[model samples]
Target chain A: MTAGPPSLTQDEVSSSPTRCRILATAERFFREIGYQKTTVADIAKTLGMSPANVYRFFDSKKSINEAVVERLIGEVETLISRVADRPGLSASERMREIILALHRDSIERITAHPRIHEMVEAGMTESWEVCSHHVERITAVLARVIAEGKAAGEFRVADPAHAAGCIQTAILRYCHPVLIVRCPGDVAPPIDGMIDFLLGGLRAG
Target chain B: MTAGPPSLTQDEVSSSPTRCRILATAERFFREIGYQKTTVADIAKTLGMSPANVYRFFDSKKSINEAVVERLIGEVETLISRVADRPGLSASERMREIILALHRDSIERITAHPRIHEMVEAGMTESWEVCSHHVERITAVLARVIAEGKAAGEFRVADPAHAAGCIQTAILRYCHPVLIVRCPGDVAPPIDGMIDFLLGGLRAG
Candidate 1:
C-alpha cells in the first residue's frame, strides 16, 4: 500500500555523476529510438559503461524507467504547484490557468517528443506505482485551488476535495494523453467549449 | 471513413436460423474459451458446418465478434431507451435513474460474465467501428433525457447534446468496463460521491 517510485533527490543526482550519466543516456536512447526497444545495455553502451556498472547505480531496468518517468512528472508537479500557489489571481482565474497549463504541457510534450510520450503511456498502462502517485499529486494541486475558492467565496461547493476530483474526471478528455490524441479528429465537442461548460457549471449559483 | 458494423435485424434473425445459430454458437465459444481463442473453424466445427459456410454469413472472424458484441450492446441500448422514456418521472428523476441504470447495468454485466466483458473491452480498445456506433447511440439516449430536462425546467442547459456528451466523458470512470476494473481498491474517490458531485454541478443555479 505504501509502494511508490523513489524520488531522485537533488543531492543524489548532483552528488553521483555516474547515476546522472546513466539516466541522461537512457533518456537519449528513449527519445531517439523508443522506450520499448531501448535497453539498459544500450544506455550503458551509449555512456561507454558496462551494463553491470549501470546496474550498480540502478537496481534494474524497471527502476531506471521509473526514475525517468518520475523526473518528467516531477517537472509537471513543480510547475502546477507554482501556478496554483501564485498570488494576485482569483480562484476561478487560477483554476482556469492551471487546467489550461496542464493541458498545454501534456499536448505540447507529446507533440514534441512522441517517443518520450510513449514511455509515459507505457508507464500508465502498466500501472506503475509512480504513475499512480503522479496522478494523486496532480489532483492535489487542483484540490488546493478549489479549497482556496471555497475560502474566497468564489465557489460554493460543499467539499473541495470531492469537487476537485469530479473536475479532474470531467476534464480527462482534454488532459489525458491518449484521449487528447483521439479527440481532435473526431466530431466530439471542442476542448475549449467543454472547459467553458464546466467553468459555467462551477460558476452557476 | 464510412465503415461501421452491419446491423443484424430481428427480421434477419427470425428468417435465417443458420445465421442465428452461428452467432449463438460464437457467443458461447467466446464465453467459454475467450474471444481471442475462438475461431471461425471452431465455430463451424461446433455447428457442423464448414468455415466457408460460416464466412458466408459473417465477412470475417472479426465481423462475427462485432456482431456478438453488438448484440450485447443492443440489449443495453434498448434498456437505456426504456429508462429514458418511462412515464411519470420528472426529467431530473429520469436523468438520475437513467444514469444509475446504465452504471448498474454495465457493472452488473461485467461482474456477472467477466469473459463477455472481455469481448466488450476488446471492441472498445481496438476502436471497432461497431463500438463507436454503440457509444453514439448511448449518447443519444442521454441527450434525449437532457432535452426533456431542459424542456421541463428541470435543467437550464442550453445545449442538451453537448451536455450529454460531456456527461458521458465525465462518467467514463464509473461506466467504462476497463476503468471499473481498475478503480476499486485504489485511493481514488468513490463512484457514488463522484456522481453526487456531478449531479450537484448539473443542478447548479
Candidate 2:
C-alpha cells in the first residue's frame, strides 16, 4: 500500500488510523452512555483530541453514528461471510449456521450492550440507506447459498433471489434488534423450528 | 337478554352504551391528537361527560388504550376467524386471504389514521399483555386452519400449533404496525410470493 501525504483525500483519510480511532472511541461512548446522550465532543475528549479534529473526520454526530454502526455490523457481515464460504457444508447446513450466527450475534449485542441499541435505532431512522444497503448485502449472500442449493438439486425454488428475500424476511423476528428487544417473551416458534419450516419450503417439490 | 340493574359489575359496565361511547370518543381523540397528547378529560369533554365517569369506565389512560387496542384487534381476529371458517375454501386459500387481509388492514390503518399508530405504539409499549393476547388469538386462528388443512390432507405439517406460530411470526414484517411504518420501502418479497413460499413449507413432506 502506498503511504499517502498529510493532505489525504477523503477515501485515504477513511482508511487512516485516526478515523479508526475516532470510530472506536465513538462506539465506546455509545455503548457506555447511549447514542442519544453521547456527543462528538465526548468522543473527542475521550480520545484526547479536539472537537474540530473529530469534525474533520466526521461532519456530524449522525455521520459518526453511521460509521460506528457500519463498524459494528461489519463484524457480523464478516462472520456470516465466513460461514457461507465454509467447505464441505451443505446448503441447508450453511443456512442454519448463518441464521444461528445472526441470531446469536443480535442476542449477544443486545444483552451485553443494551445502550448500543440506541445507535442502531438512530442508524435505522436517520441513516436508512446504510441499513438498506446492509440488508441488500445480506440478501445477496443468502441468494448465493440458495442458488447453490438449487443447483445441487437440494431445493426446488424457481427463483433463488426471491426465495432468499422471503427467508430473510421470515427470520427477522428472530434476528432483528428492535423485534428481539420489544418481544422479549416472544410467543413465536423457536429459531430451530422456524429454520426447519423454512427449509421445508426450500426442499418442497 | 338478561339486563342487569343500575349498579353494574365490571363486566356489565364494560358492555354499557356509556362505556362504548367513552371508548369511541377516546379512539377519536387518540386518532386526532395522538396517544401521548390525548387525555381522559379531552375524551370526556368531547362526549359531554365527566372525567369521573370516564374513570369509572377506565381506571387510567393506559387501561383505555388496552381496551382500544383490544377493540381494534378484535376486528382483525374476527376477520381472520371468518376466513378460517369460510366454506369450501382450501387451507392454502384461507391462509392467503388471512395474510392479505392483515396486510391490507395494517396499510389502511396506517394510511388513513397515521396518528392512530401512536395508540398502537402505546399499547405495545405500555400494555404488552393486550398485544400478547392479540397475537395469541391470531395464532390460535391460524392453528385451527392448519389443523383443518392437515386433516384434509392439504398440509403435511406434524404440529399445527407450532407451524401456525412460525407462520404468524414470519409474516410480521408484512403485518406489524411498527415494521410496516418503519420499513416503508421494504425490500422483502411481495406478499403473494411470501404466501406462496410459506405454503410450500406447509405442503412439503
Candidate 3:
C-alpha cells in the first residue's frame, strides 16, 4: 500500500542545484555524524567544493545548517500554502487535509529520518522564534480555513483558534511513529478516529 | 492552587541543599550562556572551585550535563511513576496527571529557559536512544496501568499497545507548550479531553 521513499522532486531549482545539493549532502552528513560534528569543510568536500567556496555560499557552519533546515521546512511551508490556496475545499476538510499531510510527512519524513530531524531540532535549540514562527504560520493557515468553514455554515466552533491548537497537537502526535505504533502485532491506534473527533467536535450541533 | 517548583525529594540526588545549589547555579549558567560556552571550568569557577577540583565530583563536562538533566527529568519520572503505581487511578487518570505535570514543567521550566532546554534536547542529540529510552520506559509504565485498568473493567480498550501509543503521543504533545496553546484572550481546549480521546475514541460506547 505504501511506496518506498518517493523520489525527491529535483527540478524545482534547476538554476541553483548546487546549493540544494550542498544542503542535501549536509543533511546526510549531519544525520550520519551530527550537527556538532559535521563541519563546513566536510559538507563542501562531500559536495565537491572547496571549503572556501562553501564559505561563499554560507559564511559559517551555522549558516549552512540554518540553510538546510530552512530548505526542509520550506517544503513544509509550501504544503501549507498549497492547502491554503485550494479553492472550494471546506474549512473542516482543509483542516483535515492539513493534519493528514503533516502527520503523514512527519511519520514518513521526520520519523524515518529521526537522526537528521533530531539534528535539526538541536540546531533550533532554544530558538523559540524558529518554532514559534513556523507554528504560527501553520496555525494561521488552519485558522483561515476554519473561519471560512464557519462562515460557510459547514462547521460549528466557538473558537477557531482553539480548534487550530487541538488539531496541531493531534497531528503532531504522529511524529514519533515507533513509539506511537510499532508494526507487527502492535495494534496501532486508529488515527482516523482522531479526524472523526475533530470533525465531530466542530460540526453544527 | 499551583505551587512553585517542588523541592527535590530525598530520593533525588539533589535532595541535599548543596547539590540543589549546584543544580540551581548550573541551570542559571546553562540558561544565561550556551551549554558549550559554559564549560566545567566556568561552572567550577562560579561555584568557587578550582578547575581541577571540579573533576572531583563530575568525571567530565558531559557527565555534569547528564547529572543536571537526570535531576530535572528524575522529578518528572517520579511523578509519573507515582501516578502509574496508584491503587485506583484509571489509565486515563494516570495519563492526565502525567500530561499535566509534563505540561506544567515544559511551560514553567523548559519554556522559561528555552536555550537551556534546547541544549538539553541537543545534548541528547547524539542519540535518540536517550529520549527513546525514556519514551519506552514511560510507555511501559503506562502499559501496565492500562492493562490493569482493562483487567479491572475500569477501562475498555481493544489493545493496550495501541492505547499506550496514543497515551505516549498525547503526553509528549506537551513538550511544545507555547506552540500548542495560545496565551491570551483564547482558552485552549481542555487537555482532559485529549486524555479521554487517547483512552477511548470519542465515544466509549
Assign candidate 3 its CAPRI class: incorrect
Residues A1-205 of candidate 2 have per-residue lDDT tens digits of: 4333334578867888998999888888898889999988888898898787777778799999998888777888899999999999999999999999999999999999888778887888889888888888898888899899999999998898899899999999988887887775678888999999999999983
Candidate 1 chain A worst ten-residue window by lDDT: A179-188
The candidate with the higher DockQ, 1 or 2, is: 2
Mark the regions of model 2 whose C-alpha exceeds 4 Å error after superposition: A1-8, B1-8, B48-50
DockQ of each: 0.31, 0.62, 0.13
**Alpha carbon deviation, residue B84, candidate 1 (Å):** 2.0
TM match of model 3 to true structure: 0.52
After superposition, candidate 1 runs with Cα above 4 Å error: A1-15, A28-35, A85-88, A113-118, A125-128, A181-187, B1-15, B29-34, B113-128, B182-187
Which regions of candidate 3 are displaced past 4 Å? A1-21, A31-37, A84-89, A111-114, A126-128, A176-188, B1-102, B105-168, B175-205
What lDDT would candidate 2 get against the real structure? 0.88
Query: Interface root mean square deviation of every model, in Å?
Result: 3.5, 1.3, 7.0
How accurate locally is residue B39 in candidate 2, as Cα lDDT from 0 to 100?
90
lDDT of 3 by residue, A5-34 (tens): 233333533346666687788888876776
What local lDDT score does residue B46 receive in model 1, on the 0 to 100 scale? 90
Q: Write the per-residue lDDT of candidate 2 for residues B106-153, one digit (tens) a residue.
A: 999988888887888788878888888999999999999999999999
